[model samples]
Target: MDTIAVDPDLYAAQSAYAPDDWQSETTSIRSSIYRGLMDNGRRIPSDEQQFETYEAGHLVDLILDSDRDNPLFRSPIGADRERPLQVLDIGTGKGTWAIDVADMFPNATVRGVDLFPPPVTWMPPNCVIEVDDVLQDWTWRERFDLIHMRNMIGSFDNAEWDRVYEQCFEKMAPGGWIEQLEVGPFITSDDNSLPEDSALASWGPILQKCGDRAGRPCDIVLTMPQSIKNAGFVDVHEKVYKWPIGPWPRDQKFKEAGMVNSQHWMSGMEGWCMWLLTKYGDPEPWTKDEVHVFCAKLRNELKNPHYHAYHKA
Candidate 1:
């Protein structure tokens, strides 16, 4: 639900694509939520609502806490109060990190950048947001003490990511930290809950194929760590978190978040898949009925909690 604002001319030109022509698809589809809201006689929340719903989860809080406690972030920035420390969150959807970090470090200024208009709003004096694609060429007159990119795999190609990291390196101050959080689409669990043919297993291959056909490989989850290190960041660290999809978790908080994420992701899966099928003329293999059933099955599988990590640089 990110509304991308491009130059008028560029936006007009791209708008010519039929509904079926856009190749890239969002991994989560909220149509089901919309339907659920409608069926329950409740209004569906806007992009802002969706963002807040996801951000309210404890998983994000845990991630932020871990990062704040990490040795790299604990390094002192000296007693220089005249110049505030700068941090950038790339592809920042809800600006959760910017808000949390600003609150955590009152002396630091944070900026969130994304291709779409940020769905959430806040007036924290220390936080700002810019609407633009980070993959595009940009000129920043200032350097940052920290650069963070999370969940950008589905949106940017591998080559584009390399370029983004290069830009981040150039914009980072000496002794700065760059953290990239990504997940391998290939899923795994110690509980042996996921079947071999599950979307968790098939997502990587399907997404890779779709990206290949589009001439932009969007699968960067597995390669982000090396990519960041290659961009010249020192004292890199990586941490992984397992996100449960549904209420099958033993932990109450995790179970709640998993149920929410599962509901969001499963409802959105069709739109994600359709964007590709409609583009590649491949809907024959996955009829609308099959797609719905698959999403339901995937949602049911979310009971097992599992995810990977690529937090580094």
Candidate 2:
């Protein structure tokens, strides 16, 4: 990708807070030792990064109707109030899903594990957060009634998947359910309106190349259902949801979700591109300026309603 000079005023009007407040709030959250960083060596947990997490979570919930309704796919661990339940949310960014699940099932204890600490000032008594890497050895055996993993697409290597699934199987109770949610790296369009040369079209291959060089290919979504079954989880079910990147869908529900998803992608482009491209792209790593130029192009593509593109999960 070519490194074009980005106009400083491109995002000037989008700032919602003063620069000082943004810097201070971001600095306050920088004390966590486990926090990940971009190739530029900047910590990941900034005000903008946290907002992307919240926005993406909200968009997915809207698309899946995960809030205010039970999952259409039922778990073997039925709703028996007499039996105490234990829930595990792996790679829970910001602990949003865990907190919601805890609220939904008051009797169930929800535990969220991730490298970074959760940001909430208050959490339900039944909900707790643990800072740990999921790829490491899991000490808890047969301890959970349900295991939930979401948006963990680019976090693990190809060789690590089997072991991770095996660990999940070992940690779940006899009749527990394991649900894995992920968006495929590829972008598609029903009407073929998405230009082949568009920045959005180029995103997947670039990221995939980065992942391959980093030893963690991000194509696991294509094979996770089989992997789960191989791990000895019975009755594995996969439900694919298409999330429009722009507000071009006819259905009101999808249109709403598409709007939010568009915003989510817009806000997340910088953070996503910077680290992956800088650290793993072969031949030559992408500089911050090149990432900025690429992201500017991506933002423009995301807003083009004529593209009619959507990503599947």
Candidate 3:
């Protein structure tokens, strides 16, 4: 019988916080999520990573704004009790952002659409999570007050992205705002703390090449502004962030944010790269074992205290 490949990247993370047999009964959707500790895979680590909120976007928010009181979305759609607003979140991974927005404004009906349905068992009365491919024609009857997407880099080819944006333009109400955020895959160091020959340094270029071959470029953060404008959106506002990968920053806020963000990486990196590398790896498509070795090296490098690498978010 052919053996199932052990995901060494997830195994490394599991060994640290969970037993070796922790994920004995795991979910398998291209390794997109797990189901060991909670109903949804996103709730697997609540004890240490602050999983008090299921589907931990709380940690994501800490880094996004140091857990400040910034609005769930920046789109000023005038959502209130009087005028029910229509909000849409494309590529709503785990549906945390959409749920949060739904809870924030009960008057607004929030709809989250993704290619894969979340393992979410419960949802806000006003929030709806649906499985749909955005590249296809949209079935939403009502125009949206706000359309949002984030962490969607490399999810679409250039033409697909253009089509998706065009759909967003067509489906949105007049004066509706469209918001998107994408993170850079490259890790950078201001003081050369990350070595040039290290796996950390090479990861970005490696995946960039793979993503290019896959026809879904990973450098979406750099090109999105122009792309959004090209899609007929005007007056685009841009915000760039340096999200530290580990708790190495001197500042208290960044240190805390980094600590949480490290979990984000340890848990998320392999899933992010698996399909791309296995399908479009340089010189040849990589075996799962080869990707495992690469992820192991990166995990070690990421754990180093001296490296001050931050991803552009």
Candidate 4:
């Protein structure tokens, strides 16, 4: 794989913390993998993770694009006629989704809020990024026409998640739409080819254990629709998309999506697992070396064509 070339301006736009400071913060939980630091102090992998994020956004666009009936969202706001639309994207990593949506609907105002500032220097005039944590109280004055939350499966605990939906309700205009896209942590194999002892098989349980111990469970995807409805959203609907972990599918579209999806998970395995396992792995906590070894094994399993594993979003 080629080294992902990140724009220098993106690095320059990062918060004032020096690279050394970020390194110091991760020392206790650091692995051999050199993870990059977000302004909010979370450790992400290298430029590969950024590229994966961008590519993942494209995959979602492709999925939504194919659904010509409800292209952007099932929300009625944008479907009928042209009017000013307000959109809020929660946990907007790198602001890719917000930028894309802003570009798609040039007349709409798109605001992305995240713990870290967005790296990109240029975006549509209608699009803006703000530094904010969604777990806290929301203080926005304007009500949004559409609220989008995606890929934030492991970010909140039970109570925090309740508050998130409530805030979405409070901040949304009447008849507004709230759409959340999250992938479940569990990996499944349709062909039952995955070995019971495989590293890929163990990944979800380990993450669930860690997340439970840390007070932020990873199973929110299962109950999010109900939560949204409880928060007063009417006409709630959900559509599941199965993403193959590797390029094992026969369908052309799924094959391409799986290839990108596989690469995304492969490159991000270390960054996602190391700290969680080190901090919360039960029975025995994992050392950096152990985490590294486990990740290597998991990556190999991901590449094995016989595994035929897929995750749902």
Candidate 5:
């Protein structure tokens, strides 16, 4: 469902892969939720329906950080607003975050790069949402003041991840900052509202194993701290949040965040799981129908009000 725009001249001159020769075998007609790019090995959806899901995720992020002065990002880059800053957003799905940041820092140049261009019609003069694969050599002339990535958990393997972080370090200005946010795949309840024996409870380990089997590890949320440090970044700051799954939280902000996040999961889960489960399910590869049936059960569990399910971020 995702559409990528590759520059033909750039591809021909800089790489061996052609645009048309660039299809992934992971696409399944039976699973309407997903298509893959062999380049990033990513199956994040991009249709109108799925774009709504990504928009919901962007809203959830805003609601969670609403109390902060600048919820767009935590990097301390734009303290002197008049001073021109360069910012790069890797994996900029939907481009809402990049657009907001551009507005926030009108003098700054904000570049939102992704394998697929965001489904946005218009952007601010300071914002540029371009299609790019970051694994290749970065061609930008100016170094970035801030480099940010979010929801990029399963996009790369270990070596590729090191390369990405290294690129982040190399492309950044001398005192630049890098921030990444990822959510845990596990759904958990503190008061045992959801039983451990339930199929929904097994969601974490199931996909974790599937990701491992597929060679793109999905445990980036847990391992990112050390990995970032290993990439030569210092003065690392970490923040964690317990993101409630449904509108079950008593606090007003969390309840609102949960409501948005519920839709996020409802819309994005099928696409997220299709490639991993169908290609690397336990016992054997599962059929696309089986993946859809399992996602339906998960959705039902998410809709249960009594179950206070949440995943760590």
Candidate 6:
């Protein structure tokens, strides 16, 4: 089996944090301490940075806000009185959404299904994290009232998504709701602000190719709304939000989040690129030292009030 090592230059370029946040600790993705971990097999500024709600509360809130109709816990879509709803959160990364849902709807039973165990800090009275792949040929005997899937673009294909939706449709009670959220990777700004030849633009095609080579179609975001409609769903609605990648926005809150996100991006770049190269050529063409320097420059630019990048999902 081929395995990749965490690049030392990439790790060293991370933004300095408080001693408490930067404690010299090592944990695998299987561990609870590594909650909110995302591995697309790359080394970027934020590659190893755990995305717990505690560390990124505002970003989590912003993401959840878009799913107000069929929230992780609350069955606001078609709630009934005198019934305790059952909800399923697919790909429940970090269990932040699951935790919030459990707290929001005390009466509901929320189940989070992911490949790994739940983090220790993810405990909530009404929530349970089950170790399972949502794509597996499994049956729930039509048990859940609401199903929610978020951020599974890079991890699943259309066939898998269709099957999962079909399963959800069967499992959901009559008049139940299934909500899906995904970030579109191949995004281009109508404005020339995002140079057509930039990393963000190139990332989409490379990722798409990688997914294709791996036997999974990665471009799902552009087709999610259509997929939902095809999955026998009603009231299919879609909304788009621009998440700034750097502190370039006018809003103070957005700028702050973007700044942090930019640094995180800077920290994780080489890991990401190196992984891509391994899957696709010789990283010798791109020195690890050059990657570190570029990431450092990106991080500094993120602090500039004028620097801006958007996260369109």
Best by lDDT: 5
TM-score of 5: 0.84
Could you list the CA RMSD of all candidates, in the order they appear? 13.1, 9.5, 9.3, 11.3, 14.1, 10.1
Ranking according to lDDT, highest score first: 5, 3, 4, 2, 6, 1
Better of 2 and 3 by lDDT: 3
List, residue by residue over 61-110, the lDDT tens digit for candidate 6. Answer: 34334335432323354345347878888888666667666766777788
Give one digit per residue, the lDDT tens place, for model 1 in 123-231. Answer: 4788888898787777667798888776565566567778999999989888787876654454444445455677565655675677667655545655676888888
- Which candidate leads in TM-score? 5
Tens digit of per-residue lDDT, candidate 3, span 1-313: 1111222343344322221121331221111112222343345533432123224334445345734454466666654567889999998867877886787688889999988877676788999999998988898899998999988887789999999999999998988989987878898787787899999899899999999999999999999998989999998998877777665665655554555566666666787788999999999999999999999888788777667788787
lDDT of candidate 5 over 16-72, digit per residue (tens): 111111122112112211211112223244456667666667767777787788877
Q: Point out where model 2 deviates above 4 Å.
A: 1-51, 66-68, 71-78
Q: Model 5, stretches more than 4 Å misplaced? A: 1-47
Q: How would you encode candidate 4's per-residue C-alpha lDDT over 1-313 as one tens digit per residue?
A: 1111222342342321121232332232221111212332323433646545544444534542453543455566665447888999998887767876787787789999999886675678999999998878888888999999877876888888899999999998877889987778888776677887888888888898898898877777888999898888888887877776655665545554565566567656787777788988877888999999998788777666666777777
Clashes of 1: 3
TM-score of each: 0.67, 0.80, 0.81, 0.80, 0.84, 0.69
Give the Cα error of residue 14 in candidate 1, in Å: 46
How many residue pairs in model 2 have overlapping backbones?
0
Candidate 4 stretches with Cα past 4 Å from truth are 1-51, 57-72
TM-score, structure 3 vs. true? 0.81
lDDT of 1 at 165: 90
Give the alpha carbon lDDT tens digit for every residue of 147-201 in model 2. Answer: 8887787778766888888988888786788887787878778768798888899
Rank all candidate structures by their TM-score, best first, as comma-separated numbers.
5, 3, 4, 2, 6, 1
Each prediction's Cα lDDT score? 0.54, 0.68, 0.72, 0.69, 0.76, 0.55
lDDT of 4: 0.69
Off by over 4 Å in 1: 1-83, 215-218, 251-257, 280-290, 300-313
